[model samples]
Target: MGINTTKLKRGFRELFGKTVQAFIVQLRMETGLMLIENTDLSISEIVYRVEYSYPASFTQAIRNHYGKTPQALRCLA
Candidate 1:
């Protein structure tokens, strides 16, 4: 799609009330949560599955977004 950056950002914010980066991280965290719930994948595995670079970064993102680490979330399962 020939998305113009200014328009795309504006449209995304209008539609979702969030920036693109926020939307992407939300998607990553949701997939990470589902993987934690349903799969026996390791934290690192889940991180990479969501296209995250490292375990700590993934951990921090999960913590920031959901207020729990991947391990802690898995423990809920």
Candidate 2:
């Protein structure tokens, strides 16, 4: 196939207004929010399930993208 990682990532960002990684993270956040709102999964569990390599990084990404930590978001929900 002609699609390389760089081109694919660029196309994803062009089409979605976020890099592929960011978009995936966004999706994970959305779902995580839903889970937080509706389910009983612990924060750490959600972090791991979201595919972040570590809880700290996931918390950082959540803060960076949503302007809130996962715990804060859960509190808000």
Task: Report lDDT (CA) for all predictions.
Answer: 0.91, 0.82
User: For this target, which candidate reaches the highest TM-score against the unseen true structure?
Assistant: 1
- Model 1, range 1-77, lDDT digits (tens) per residue? 79888998999899999999989988998999999999998888888899989899999988998898888899999
74: Cα error in model 1, Å: 0.6
- Candidate 1 residue 20 Cα shift, in angstroms, is 0.7
Give the residue spans of candidate 2 off by over 4 A: none
lDDT of 2 by residue, 1-77 (tens): 78898898888888999987777878988887777677779878888787777889878877887899888888887
Q: Could you tell me which 10 consecutive residues in candidate 1 have the lowest summed lDDT?
A: 40-49
Worst 10 residues of 2 by lDDT: 31-40
Give me the candidate number with maximum lDDT. Answer: 1
Error of 1 at 56 (Å): 0.5
